[model samples]
Target chain A: MAKSKSRTEAPQDASEDVVMQELPTSHQPDVQDDASMAEVDAEDDAEVEDEEEIEDDTQRVRLLPGSTPTAASFEFLNEGHTLGNALRYIIMKNPDVEFCAYAIPHPSEPKMNVRIQTYEGTTAIEALQKGLKDLQDVCDVVSDKFVAAQKDFKKKSISS
Target chain B: MDYDPMAMDEIESKGPVIKISQADTVRVKFELSNADISFANSLRRVMLAEIPTIAIDLVEIEDNSSVLADEFIAHRLGLIPLNAEGIEELQYSRDCDCEEYCDHCSVKLTLHARCTGDENMQVVARDLVPSGDRINRVLGTPIINESSDGLGPLIMKLRPGQEIKLQCIAKKGIAKEHAKWAAPSAIGFEYDPHNKLHHLDMWYETDAKLEWPPSEYADWEEPPQEGERFDFNAVPDRFYFNVETAGNIPPDAIVTEGIKVIQQKLASMIHDLGETEGGENGDYNGPRSPEYNGGGDGWQDQGFTTPYGNGGNQSAWGGGAGGTTPYGTTPYGGAGAGNGGW
Candidate 1:
């Protein structure tokens, strides 16, 4: 039975492999047919290269050049408001953080640049790590409560 | 301010608490107290978009004589929720090492329907056959017959002599990519029932209560009396959530999964921060070391040697939090495992 199934699906699988390989290059001619479209494609290609470069580098978090550890703008690749806003909130809760804010340079780009200025006692990197730890603790508490509540609900429902 | 014993007791009892008021297979209503607005909103957004589910992603039609266009049927197929009981075991198609798709990453479902008699025939999700035992259509109570096998969502109808043959590949994905993979049909989040924080401006003709009636949840707390003084310093710390699942997963599992997603995201960020090279003033030339290309294998190796030198034991992080790799099955290969750090 397994052999029969594989035999029937063999042709379909081969065709799909071809389709996958052709997918990226198939749209190139359509864009090149028009001059303005070609220009837009070129710009898009440059943006893709930028994204690739960011991805290729193992260091997702980088300290911007010409910035001090105490006051710096750190670039976080492949992150958006989900992490940015939450991190900002957690960092701001600390008394040593003088200023903290995050901004996405562009909407299309998956990058979040956070600027942090801390008081003389602490550095921005330390504050950021503390914020991440605090946020994880918060999530742990929430998850535990949720699981306990769910169990209680289940028991009550079964008893009733 | 003096430290009063009564206030201290109040503070001790105010630690985070979750109360489940209602729960069933497909719906759950719960209250989360003592968490700030940021945490509550984050959980809600993650549940709606981040938690992964299985859905028909690619469809190939071999023959279709039905009135509907092939694209229309394919789009409808993508919306049907498949059982995702063990979806975490399945790797994402993009992350899997296959040319197109394999059983490890995708489930093949085929449907062949042909009508011959004079009567019209109806095609439903039950007719589609799955290639593997792990995935199948979510079957709810039958609308027509109670004793019959639970019915699935209707796919299409066919007239006499009309036929439709198709093959669909179901893959695991998050709602962030497409709504078809959304875990919940609707998630109702409410906070500040009395509006003491004035988050919303109540617009009404004469009486605010008459036009905008309070939800049933408002009864959980005392309703504000007429001309009652409001505390401006009060911040909304309690959140109420009503989650209705799309039947791909259980209601409680969705909440836990969402929380896990948030934890994994934070863990990966922290892990990356630990590997960052340049913190010295005026020394950022963009990660000069070509050896640490941030590929899956490179980071996996580095996690063992320099496992968060500053941050204590990597295992203490999100690694054992859920007993699963933080980004083990994540769609983005860049975010996956680094030794003890999930």
Candidate 2:
């Protein structure tokens, strides 16, 4: 289940189109050069982002049985949304979700950087649905990159 | 508080103190019509109610169940369900309950060992119950929960041929010091091909919570071993129906459909027995056996209408029915035309 960190960064530099072209061989792509490049980019992004307003957009929720939402301070996110607007809209719906600022490219939708955050004990499916609904409910959302997707059990189980 | 050097030394010398040690038991003395029904469910429920802990480690396979040979076989061989009942023992993870012994909660081991051992052992409960400890080892894992102080990890070993026993001790409470024991509740079944009615009875000895009026005819007997032919009529009302889950097919499964129907009826009978209320013995005090019905003539009404009729008057697998044979005559009566047919 464990893969070398060195082999998972080439496509990060390549645009979604380039990555898509290499999708067939994505599983075993060259990672040494890409990983080093990713490390450098991450460092650069970290410095710039630390200096700027620290917009903690990341959220995480424990997927468990019989967990309910409490003290709503953060909203959910989903697909079909204007970029920045969805994040802000989700925050409005759930005023309780604290921002950690960890964002990653949506696995299916590369154009958008999806923020990952945590929530209280709740089913992964329910949490994702709520996040998606919130993202779609907001108006005047923008799109430098806008996409939403929930974690799927199939992918997690297979990979793990 | 005062401390005694000698006492302290004694305590230290007893390394890895098994403060909470028990042997709780659940003996299911039962009777059932040799029918094939979901008896496995009943076995599971009884195990759960009693053991409540001890993660099942492993189950061995032995024999399958069959309806032939006038006997019943368990579902599996060796140990049917590897992790059947052992979760509770893991919960007894505390000190002794006595003045310093284990008490109400601690390391609990639940064990369920069945007679039959040749079937695919299904996992009925997996860490189903937990301990009442405030601190848990694994958090966020499927088995352990951090919120309520009950769920705890289980680490114990169990193998085949051993009487399945779940033992535990109280963690910090007074109950920990006290040793308790439990055995699997006894269960049995019987099938009458003639009446086509399966009769089952399940019994257990419990603290005097209710009084069970005893029936003079409280016929309890031991079940037959594998491949043994049992006089279905002679099977008492309360015998252990030894079943195998793997090695050999239980004699009861030979007549699959009949046994299945009988199993359903037996399950209901057990439920009824559980619901019976009265006395501490779990049985009411009354004339033991039913009024001795004169001779074997009344056997048909009692659900044993086979070619040889009820087993009361016959011996060994019914002598192929009573026939009027004068001088060396060929057997030509009842279902004897062919060697079998009920």
How far residue B89's Cα lies from its native spot in candidate 1, in Å, is: 1.0
TM-score (all chains, Cα) for each model: 0.73, 0.16
Model 1, total clashes:
1
Q: Weakest 10 consecutive residues, lDDT, candidate 1 chain B?
A: B1-10
Residues B111-188, model 2: lDDT tens digits: 343334544232222332333442343210123223324333232222333223232221221111211111222223
True contacts kept of each: 0.39, 0.00
Task: Assess each model's interface with DockQ, reporting 2 decimals per model.
Answer: 0.17, 0.01
Q: Supply the DockQ value of model 1.
A: 0.17
lDDT of each: 0.72, 0.27
Worst 10 residues of 2 chain B by lDDT: B14-23
lDDT of 2 at B169: 26
Residues A20-81 of candidate 1 have per-residue lDDT tens digits of 32233432223224554456777968866774555444456765432455666677877777
True contacts kept of 1: 0.39
Q: What share of the true interface contacts does candidate 2 keep?
A: 0.00
